[model samples]
Structures are given as structure tokens and as C-alpha cells.
Target: MSTVVAVLGATGGVGQHVCSAFRASGDRVLGIARRPSAAGSALRLDLAEAAPAQLAAALTAHRTEIVVNATGGWVLSAEAMHLAHVQIVERLVAASTLMPDPPRIVHIGTIHEYGPVPAGTLIDESRRPEPQTGYARTKLAGSQALLNATAAGTARGVVLRAVNVCGPGTTSASFLGAVLDRIRDVRPGDRVPMTIADARRDYLDVRDLTDAVVRAARAPESTVGQVINVGRGEAVAMRQLVDWLLAAAGLPPDTIDEQGAAVQSKGGDWTRADNRRAARLLGWQPRTALDASLRDMWHDAARRYSEA
Candidate 1:
């Protein structure tokens, strides 16, 4: 039987891909977002302010079997982060409890929730979260809310702690996305400023992350209440990754403003994911090559540049 999936933040980067993946697999998709899109049936509502009863009615009316909470904010303000991550999640959990048969919830979480891992340590689901930034802290709170709901049997919840996601149509706020934006707009000799160039971080293709979420949604009830780490399982230096992106965009090696590329943040200095659980539980692994993903991102940026 085809499942009915509702994706919150359906117009966002990862959310859009999740909706597309489910639709491609023949599932009925309802997109809940503040704006309309081609992904699924539109339910225009700001989850942050929407009451539980309103959210419950929307889900029940759509007969949603799975709810993917993909809504998140990258804002620096603590209040905005809390509203987007924590408050919205709290409301979603409440809505799930009101359902006759509460739908499975796949909460998209961030690897940053684990905070700073040691230089060579591989982080798994068991790592103690030490979120430092407002974004990370808020996301952790939301993750705990989902886990708590599952433990109480009010919802079947799975938290997928995903690493940095990059691909075509990535948002400009992301590291790679910022690089793509610069390359598209700057001339060959023009320099672009960046930070944390030496940080070793994991990057997952949006498609790969979407596949894991879809699998988590369909997995057995035993998978419920589980916190899974979904990532590329390998770390690449940010400097090296930026060079790769520049090359993919056909930019010169000196395009980066070396003097301006000093470390501006320590948030991603060293972080890598141990994806054993995702492979074992969801039979998922990243398949897209880094170069291929960067190429797609470059092409997307180029297309947007032309249109601008």
C-alpha cells in the first residue's frame, strides 16, 4: 500500500528532495510549508505559530502516515532558532498524539548537535551532544522532544542526525553553496572570503539523506525511538573541498582570497559521522561522488546566475 507522507518545510533544501523522493516512489505526498511548491499538495502554514489542533486536523485530513519534520532555521538569534526548531517540533509531537493512529515521524536533525568532536574521533549516535551555537542547541532540544514523544508511546519517532548536506539547489547559507554563489558571480581573478578552511567535516548528498529518511519512514516499528546517524562516513578537509568546487566551476586556483580565508569559526573544525547504524538499519550508504555533486551544484549556480 502506498504511504501518505507529509513533509514539513517542503520548500526547503532537504525537505524538497525528501518530497521528491517519496513522490518518485509512488507515495502520496502532502507538502506543509509557508509557501507553495510543485512537490506535493500544499498546506500553507507556519508550523512555529500553528497550534497542535490545527496541525492535527491537517494531518488527519490528509491521512498522513508519515511526517517528516524538516523545518529548521539557520538564524543566529536564539529566539528564532527556538521557534523554528524547538517550538515547531513540540507542536508536531502534540499533533501526533492527537491522531487516531499517530503517524511515524522522521525528524531531520543536524550533526552539529553533537558539537565539537575530537580531531580524529568518529561520532556515532552514542556521542554526547554539546551543542554550542544557537542553531545546534535549538535542534538538539527538538531532537530530544521527538525522542521523548517516542518513549512515551505517543509517537513513532526516528531522529536522523544528518551531516552537512550539499547538492544542486543548495541554499546560499551553506558552505559549499556560498562557494558556488561566489564562483558564479566573481571573475577568475576576483577573490572570495571564507572561513574554517582547514576544518575536516563530512558532507552528504541531499539525495542520500533523503533516501535514508524515506527508509526510516518505512522501516519496522522496531526502528521507532531510534536515533540514527546519517552521513557520508568520511571527512574531507574544507580547504580541499573548496578547491574541488572551484575547479568544478572552472575557476582558477587563486580565486580564493587567501588573506581573507582566515578561520572565522571553530564550529566545524573536526566532525565526522560513523554511519554503521544507518547501513545496518536502513541499508543506506552515500552513492554520489563528491565531484559529481559539486558539478551539479556548479551547474545549478550557473543557471541561476544567467537568469539573474
Candidate 2:
């Protein structure tokens, strides 16, 4: 039987991928976003401020069995982050309880929630989250809210703490996305200014992350009420990744005018995931190659820039 899936923040990078993954799997997808597009069954709804009754009605009307909370704010103000991450989650949990058969929630979280890990250490789901920035704190709060609802029997919830996701359609604010923008704006002699190039991060293809979400949504009750780390389980230096991207874009090494010197890494120079739980429970792993993902990002960005 085809599952009815409701994807919140459906227009966002990860949300769009999640919606497409579900539809590709032959499931019915209902995309909910503030500015819903003509993709799938679009529903324009502000989940943060929408009444619980109204939200419940929408889910019930669509017969949604699984709801993916992909809405999040990265560089927004603290107030905006709270609204997007925390308040919206609280509202969703409340609304789900109102349904006769509450929909299972798959909350998309970030590795930032784990804060700074030791250089060689891998973060597991058991590690207590130490969110430092407002973004991380707000996202952690949202994940906690969903888990709490599951514990209270108000909802079935699973939190996937994903690492840096890179692929086509990456947001311009992301590290790789920023690099693509820089490449697009680079003139013959202009030097690209970047930050945190020395830091090592585990990057997962957006498609891999979406595959994990689909698996988590279809997982049994035993997999619910748990937090799983979703990532490639390997770390690559930011500088190396940037160099690869530049090379892929047909830019010469000398073309990079690192203004003065490379950006110094702050604390938490490494971020890698321990995907044992994800593999054991969700039966998933990163299948896309990093080089392939970077190539796709370059092509996608170039296409967008040419069209603009």
C-alpha cells in the first residue's frame, strides 16, 4: 500500500528532496510550506503560527501517515530560529495528538546539535547534544520536543541528526553553496575570500539523507522514539573539498587568490558521524560518491547562474 506522506518545509533543500524521494517510491506526497510551489500536492501553511486544530484538519484530510519536519532556519535571527525550529515542532506535536491515528514524525536535525567534538572522535546518538549557537540550540529543542511527544504517547517520532548535506540545489548559505557562488562571481584575477577552510566535516549527499528519511518513515515502531545520526561517517578537510570543487569547475589552482592566508579553524575542527545505529535500524548507508556530488553541485549552480 502507498503511504501518505506530508513533508513540512517542502520548498527547502532537504524538504524538496524528501518529497521527491517519497513520490519516487510511489507514496502520496503533500508538501506544506509558507510559500508552497506547484510541486506535488502543495499546501500553503505557516506551521509556526497555524492553529493546532487547523493543522490537524489538514493532516487528517490528506490521511498523512508520515510527516517529515524539514523546516529549519540557519542564518536567521534567534527569534526566527525559535519560530522555525522549536515553536513549529511544538505545534506539530500538538496537532498530531489530535489525530485519531497520529502520524509518525521524522524530524530532520543537524550535527551542529552535537557542538564541538574532538578532532578524531565520531559522534554517536548516545553523545549528549551540546548546542552552542542559537541555531543549534533551537534545532536541538525541536528534536527534544518530538522525542518528548513520543515518550508521552502523543506521537511516534524519530530524529535524524544529519551532517553537512551537499548535492544539487544546495542552499547558497551552505559552505559548498557559498563556494559555488564565489566561483560564479570570480573574475580573472579576483581572489575568493572564505572561512573555516581548514575544518574537517563529513558531507552527505542530499539524496543519501533523503533516502535515510524515507527509510526512517517506513521503519517499524522499534525504530521510532529514537535519535539516529545520518552521515557519510568520514571527514574531509574543507580546504581539500574546496580545491576539488575549483578543479571540477575548470579553475586553475593559481586562480584562487587566498586573500593573505587561509581562514583559521575555530574550535570543533572535525565533525564525523557514527552511523552504526542508522545502518542497524534503518538499513541505510551513504551510496553517493563525494566527487560525483560536487560535480553535480557545480553543474547545477552553473545552470542556475546562466539562467539568471
Candidate 3:
């Protein structure tokens, strides 16, 4: 049966893509945002300040069947972590459960939950979470909260631990998005400063991640309470990505800047997603390789840069 999907944060980086994917799949999608416009039944909703009753009313009014909690905030700072990552979960838990039959909740999570796994181990659903930073801790907590809400019959939930998802319209404040902008503006003598992590990790196109979410939402109810990692199984080195960006931009190697600077660690461990579980369970697999995804993002970023 076609489902009614309500995408929270429908205008966000991942939410926008997820909303687009749901529309493509013929699901009835209603975009909920704090700044809604005439853009496909937009509603003004500030999840943080919204009461449970308000949420329930919104869902009922919309007749939603699937709730994609695609809204998420990230920061390298503690205060931002609390506001962006933690409070959102609490709000969702309160608001969604108020519904008569709460919709399936697909909460977005970060790869940082698998914080700093051993240099060689592949991170899958089975790996126990070892959170290191405020960001990871809050995200891991949010994942747990969503699961608890599911077990309590408040809502059915799925958690997607996504990696460096990138695309156009991403903010420079983001790790990969900032890199895309920098690469687009590289001159003949610009050496982009980056860390030298010999570690390998997965990357995903935001759209591909959205595709995985669509599949997961359509997944059998039996797959609820599952936390899946979404990424191409292959891991790419940070340096390799830098080189790929340079080549994709059609810039000469002279534009590559290699300063003798130590790469600052983000206070977490390296980990890669074991996507076999997602593939077996939800039939989800990453369609875009990191190289290809990067190339696509470069074109989009370049175009945006030109327009600006």
C-alpha cells in the first residue's frame, strides 16, 4: 500500500533529499518545516518548541503513515550538540507518541556513534557503541531514545548511521560541504589543509542515503528496532578524496597545497559501516561510489558557485 509520509525538517540537507525520494516513489509527502511556504504543503513547525499535542494534531490532520525524522543538527561544539542533536530527539519522542497510532519513525544518526573503532575493524550493527565526543554521545542517545519509543508502542523506528554524506546546497559549516566549496575555489597555489588519517571510512551521496531511507521506510515492520549503517562498503582515505576533488575540478596539480600541518583529530575513532545487514534486511545498498559521488557534488557546487 502506498504510505503517507511526513518528512520533518523537509527543507534540511538530508530531509530535502529524503522528501524528494519519497515523492519519486509515489508516496504522499507533506513537508514539515519551521519555514514552510507554498512548496508542497509546507507547514510551520518548530519541533523543539512544539508540544506533543501539536505534533499529534499535525500528524492526524495530515493523515501521515510514515514519519521520517530526517531533521538533525550537528556540531563540533558541545553547546551546538545539545541544541541541535539532543533536544530534537526529546521533542520527537514527546510529539510523535501523542498520536493515536504513531507513524513509523526513521531517526537520522551519525557514524560517530561507532567512534574510533580499531584501525582495522569494520563497523556494522553488531559493533557496540563507544561514543567519544558530545556529538556522538547525543546522537547515540537519540538513537536509543527512538528505539525505546518504538518498544513502548509509541512509534516504530529505524536508525540510519550515515557517514560523510555530501551534495549541493550543503553549508560550509559542514565537514564535507566546506571541502567542496574550498575545492571549487582552489587557485594554482592553494594547498588545502587536511588531516593525515591513514584510516579508511565510507562516504555516501545524500540522495543515495535518502534512497536507503525510502527503502527502510517501506521495509517490513519486523525490521523496526534495527540500526543500520548506510555507506558504500569501501573506505577511502582523506588524502585520496582531496586528490579526487582536485582532478574532478579540472584543476592542475599545482593548485594542490600540502602544508606541513598536523591534522587535528575530531576526538573520535575511525569506523566503516557493514552494509551487509542493510542489504539483507532492507535491500538497501549505496548506489554512488565515493569517487563518483564526489564528482557529481563538484559539478553541483561549481554551478552554484558560478551562479553566486
Candidate 4:
């Protein structure tokens, strides 16, 4: 039976892909976002401030059985970020309670919520979260709400704490997205300048992440309410990733701005994902290799650039 899935923040980078993946799998996907999409798929509701009553009405109207929260921790702004990551989750928990058969929520959390581990440590779900930044702290709070509610038997949901995601529909806020912009912006002679903070991060393709999300939505009650870690299972150097991106895109190398590249990033020096729980729990792994992911990202950027 096809599930009725409502994807919150459906217009955002990861959210759009989540909606597409669910739709491609023959699920009835309702795109819920603040703004209407040009494709006419959005439900056009701001989830960050939506009351429990409003959410219940929407769920009832759509007959939603699975809700994929594809929002949170993407934007770095303060008030809105808190609302998106924390407040919206509280509302989602509340709304689920009003349903006779509460919809299963797949809250997409981030690896940043684990903050920085030691240099060579694998970021398993067992590690106690030490979120460093405001964005991550907020995301952790959101995850805590779901965890708490699920434990109390008040909410039916699972949390997929994902890694650094990159793929098609990536925006300028991301590393590869910024690189794509610089690649498209410069003329033949002008060199693109970037402030590179070289750190090893576990990066997952958006498609890969969304695939796990769809699986999570359909997982058995045994798997529901579990916090599964999802990612590529390995960290790659930022510089190495850039090289692969250029190679995969068949683009010429842009000059790396070496003089100012040696700064510590906010997330910290290094961390990779431990995705064993995801495979065990959801029968999922990141099937898309980084090269293929970067290739797709570049090609998608090219298509959009041409359209623009």
C-alpha cells in the first residue's frame, strides 16, 4: 500500500529531494513549505510556527501516515533557526498525539549534533552529543524532544542523524555549492577565490540520505523510535573532495586561495559517521559514491546555470 507522506520544508535543499524520492517510490507526497513551489507541489504552510491544531488539520486533510521532517539546522540564522529546529519539532510531537493512528515522523537530524570527536573517532550513536554551535545545539534539542516523546509513548517517530549532505539542489551555503557558483561565475582568465577550511567530514549525497528516510518511514515498529546514524561511513578531506569534484565535472582547476585558508571551522577539525545502525535497522547504506555525487551536483548546476 502506498503511504501518504507529508514532507515539511519541502522547498529546501534536502527537503525537495526527499519529496522527489518519496514521489518516485509511488508515495503520495505533500510538499509543506512556507512558499509555494513553481512545480505547484507545495502545501504552503510555515511549519516553524504552525500550531498543533493546524498540523492536525493538515494531517487529517491529507490522510498523512508518514511525515518526513526535512527541515532543521540548514540555515545559521538565530531566531528562525531555533524555530525551525526546535519549535517545529515540539509542534510536530503535539500534532501526532491528536491522531487516532498517529503518523510516523522521520526527523532528519544532523551529525553536527554530535559535535567534534577526537581525530580518528567514529561518530556512533553511542557517543554523548556535545553540540558546539548554536545551530547544532538547536538541532540536538529538536532530537531530544522526539526522543523524549517517543520514550514516553506519546509520539511515533524515528530520528535519522545524517552526515554532511551534498548533491543536486545544493545552495551557496554549502562547500560544493559555493565551488559550483565560483566555477560558473568566473570568466576564462579570472581566478575564483575561496576561504578554504580544510577538514575531514563525512559527506552523504542528498539522494542517499532521502533513500534512507523513505526506508525509515516504512520500517517496522521494532525500528520505529530508534535513532539511526546515516552517512557514507567515511570522512574525506575537503581538498581531496574538491579535486574529485573538478575531475568529475571535467572542469579546469581553480586556483586555491592558500594565503587565508588555514582557519579552524566552527564544527571543528574532524569527524566521520558510524552507519552500522542504519544498515542493521533500516537495511540502508550510502550507495552513491562521492565521485558520482559530485558529478551529479555539477551537472545539475550546469543545467540550472543554462536555464538561468
Q: Of models 3 and 4, which has the larger lDDT?
A: 4
TM-score of each: 0.95, 0.94, 0.91, 0.94
Worst 10 residues of 3 by lDDT: 262-271
Query: Candidate 3, residue 74: CA error in Å?
Result: 2.8
**Can you rank all candidates by lDDT, best first?**
2, 1, 4, 3
Show the lowest summed lDDT stretch of 10 residues, model 1.
259-268
Task: Give candidate 3's whole-model lDDT.
Answer: 0.76
Candidate 1, residues 1-308: lDDT per residue as tens digits?
88899999999988888889999999999999987766553889988779999999999998999999988856667788889989999999999989998999999998889888788989998888998877788899999999998898888899999998888779997777777766776777778765547678889888998999999998888899999998888888887788888888788777887554465442557878999999999988889988788888888777877887
Candidate 2, residue 225: CA error in Å? 0.5
Residue 58 lDDT, candidate 4, scale 0-100: 90
Clashing pairs in 3: 116-269, 116-270, 191-257
lDDT to native, each model: 0.86, 0.86, 0.76, 0.83
Q: By TM-score, who's the top model here?
A: 1
lDDT per residue for candidate 2 within 29-80, as digits (tens), equals 9999988786553899988779989999999999999999989846568888
lDDT tens string, model 3, 1-308? 67799988888777778887888888889898888754453778887678778888988888888888877665667766775676777777777777777788888888888777776667788888888777788888888888888888776889988876766546566666766766766676667665445556667788888888888888998889889888877667776776676777877655655565555444343557788888998887777766677787788787867887
User: Looking at candidate 2, what is the lDDT of residue 308?
Assistant: 80
Q: How much is the lDDT of residue 132 in candidate 3? A: 79
The RMSD (Cα, Å) of candidate 1 is 1.6
Positional deviation of residue 97's Cα in model 4 after best superposition, in angstroms:
1.3
